[model samples]
Target: MKNWAVISTWSMSYDGLLKASSMLQNGESAGDAVENLIKKVESYPLYKSVGYGGLPNEDGVVQMDAAFMNGDTLAQGSVAAIENVKHAVSVARKLSLNKTNSFLVGEGATKFAMQNGFEMTNMLTERAKTIWQNKVKEQFKTGLHPYDGHDTVGAVTLDQAESMSAATSTSGLFMKKDGRIGDSPLSGSGFYADSHIGAATATGLGEDIMKGCLSYEIVRRMAKGQSPQDACDTALYPFCEDLKQRYGQVGEISLIALNRKGEWGVATNVEFPFCVANEKQKAQILMANPGKNQKTQIEPISQSWLDDYQKQINAPVE
Candidate 1:
């Protein structure tokens, strides 16, 4: 292969996977390439909720959360408070490689940063501050997520070359607290990927989604050769109805996956569409949100994406 291809949604733009893959053009481990990609994002302009220019709290301070995981080693690292450190994902990767199994809260994670020689300044970039103050929740009465829109980004890649890994980071709700970490950093919820089985990620509503382990459910379905979309839908459809049936309220979630075969797929509530990377270098975007207030303009990815993904799976290469 030319290097490796990736599929994910937690990077700055829709091209995050493409951009991240570029970091691996030279010979490097998948884990190292991902770490380098995270570091590069720290100074990059597009992803604010990440590194330096993060989204702000209701009180107008920017706090960030980040996490990194490698299925090959099962090593995971994360930093929650982490101010002005630029590369949250890189720091998390360091933590993962260290003696500690995980890192800490705002002050705690910040203290970890300071001890490690990272600067602890306010990430108050002009654009970042503006987004937190004006751009976020601008017209909403509640000042954020008026329609329950989610703001989490994640990536899960098996890579054409080696090892599976996943990473996720987010600013969380537009006007959330300075320390309100979401399910993104937590495994088995927002993001989960494995080398043997599969990788699955959740978006849309973290709290609601956390009420159930969405990622694990999808992986379980994919284990049955159900295809990524079917696995996500089969795992989610029942849970979505169960939540409403048991609680009498509506909620939503989005999920995407890549199996051992380098194929990618995702499913949502039909309202929130996730962008998918097809083998043909094309993107298949889908939205699954459904209800009275639903925005009905989304379209589904073609079935060929799954068929093609499966093409790479040839009887286990005995």
Candidate 2:
């Protein structure tokens, strides 16, 4: 019997994995296991990069994107720039099951969510509002800041039935342009799954991943007989090389992959922590090594930076 396993992009995803473990033990489908995990992550209010409390766009409106892929059928569903829904990943799952529309975006996605009985709620919390306000003030002086480290949350599962499934969800970059869509909802960019080979998901710097279709490339390499680790390493090489040569530092790009044989791997341009869980093993954080030829460490804007920025925002509105 194949050992059932689930993995995700960040440490917080451990909560989701725990829940999915129960479903897998109950003989649930791999797609259901992955989608359930994503839904749980989307509902968490603390993670500011995804679902509720996610950072807003320039207009201070929270929009989310998500994708779901079923490996056995190679069916995909995605939603982009969707607002008011806390569980955007569920909407993506619904779309995949529908099989009529593989993709939906912007107003269309919102409409579909409402028609399909999704709850509409203010996704922006007071904390997110404060961050958005600070970002707007900062952008007025300098152009948009460089990409920060926190990013999309994702999950991939290998089930006892020997199938793979992957899902990803995110509120795109903070203070981004209105209607901007990231790689999260774009198949092959955010995630790819093939039951015969493996599944992969990506996070961070959507633009770079979209350019290379990085997730799909990883799964393809796995199909070519490369181990999950080798595929992840190979797929990240070009991006790492380009960033080092052009900017002298590796920008953010992290990936997680699981092969049909139940082996898993991860690679990143910077140090990233992920979670891995199986029926026989409790979930654990895996600190991934940085990519080859990585030059400089990329740090998130510090607390001091935010404190100073907040002071500027509060300076008597001058």
Candidate 3:
């Protein structure tokens, strides 16, 4: 079995996964490795769904949600509807060390980050503002439901010491209501970890993701002797089907898991791209989609896909 592993939702996390892999290979703590990995994504301006350039709310404000979990202790820290913080994941990581009031929101969360010396910046960029403005105009003119495909960067890491950590960060859905928050900052919904068992995280419609507490379910199954892959497929596929039956519809849902042995698994109801690395493998991007019989089809991401994505994210907003 591999000695360490790191897996994260979305192809956008490829670079971060590489860095985190290097940290894990060098014997760094899983918590530090995962946090720094997310920090890389949070600082990238081209990723419109995460920290620096994340899309804004309906009122033109960039509100972010983030969470961090220490598998060794089950300690979790979270922030929601926070604004202006350069790395919302960092704020959440700091809160993980607290015993009370670890979950903070709105102005209170922002204040805690400020008081704790976190970097402060205008999280909304000109490009993001332009896109949000155009989206608003389009929705107003078209009178259609707002296009809502937001991707969160959720990661699970296992270190050489067998310690595990999970974290999630996102600016939330574009044109979201003011003070609105999603599953990213909510433990069990967005992320969960346990050193003795495994770690898992989810990305997609947080509202639906929370309805089933998908992440926690995956880890719970792993603790009961399920492989990471089995846990992810069994936990996610059944929930997706049940949600569709009960709720009449389901949103895009994707999940990633890594067990203490450095094995990994993924399941998704959409064409999801993710990044992963382990002691026996270099960091690489892969694609996952729901397949026949409720299994997930996994394959290497194509260069053509990467090229197109790069162009799309970097394209100028009209």
Candidate 4:
């Protein structure tokens, strides 16, 4: 019998993985398992970078993005900059299962969600609103808002039938420019799954991951016979290399992968906490290293940068 397993991008994803594990145990489809897992994360209020309590845009509107891919068919769907919907991953799954539409954005996405019977509720919570208000008052001067540390959430599943699926969801950056769609809803950048090869998903700075098509690169490497761990390491090397060349340090960049044989791995430029679970293993948080002897070059937001921004935020109103 093929082993069943699930892995996700962050520690918070442990909850989702637990849900996925239950579904897998009950014989759910791999696609369904992953979609349900991401949907759970989207509804979590504490993880402000995802669905319900996600950070707001420059206009204080919460816009979320999500994508889902089925490895067996190489089919996928995505929604971007969607507003008021609580489970963007479900909408993305609907699109992926749709024969005609592979992607929808902005008003179109919201309209589709409404048409599909998804309740249109204000996704921004009181806590998120208060934070947004403070951010606007400070003109985002600190660049150190409460939501800055939360990254996109993602999941990859390998089921007993050997099918694979990957899903990703996020609210994008905190106080981002209006209409800014990140890598989460974009194919290859946020998530990729291929039954013939494996599956891969990414989390961290969306712009850099999108430019590199990081998740796709990882799966492609696996297709070339690289192990799950090697594929993750190989895909992350250039991202770290580019950052080192430009800023002499890397920022956060993380990936999780599952090979065709059900072996899984994770790699990150910085210390990224993630989780893994399976039929035989319980979900547990683990730190993903860049690779063996791979020197970490991740530079934290500098104290000077934070200090300057703090001063600007504290400046007396004229």
What are the clash counts of all predictions, listed in order? 11, 0, 0, 0
Clashing pairs in 3: none
Please report, in order, the local distance difference test score of every candidate based on alpha carbons: 0.63, 0.82, 0.93, 0.82
Which structure is stronger by lDDT: 2 or 3? Answer: 3
Error of 4 at 244 (Å): 3.8
Best by TM-score: 3
Give the per-residue lDDT digits (tens) of candidate 2, residues 1-318: 457888898765767888888788777889889988888877877677898878888799999999999999998999999999978988898899874876999999999999999888999988788877887788788985654524899888999999999999999887777898878888898999999999999998887778779899999999999998888887887777876787676547899999887788788876676888777766775667563363222233345644664564344421
Q: Which candidate is the best by lDDT?
A: 3
Per-residue lDDT of model 1, residues 160-193, tens digit only: 5567777766666666756777777777887776
What TM value does model 4 have? 0.87
Alpha-carbon shift of residue 86 in model 3 (angstroms): 0.3
Off by over 4 Å in 1: 2-4, 23-27, 36-48, 99-101, 118-121, 131-149, 270-318
lDDT of 2 at 123: 97
The stretch of ten residues in a row with the least summed lDDT in candidate 1 is 309-318
Query: Lowest-lDDT window of 10 residues in candidate 3?
Result: 141-150
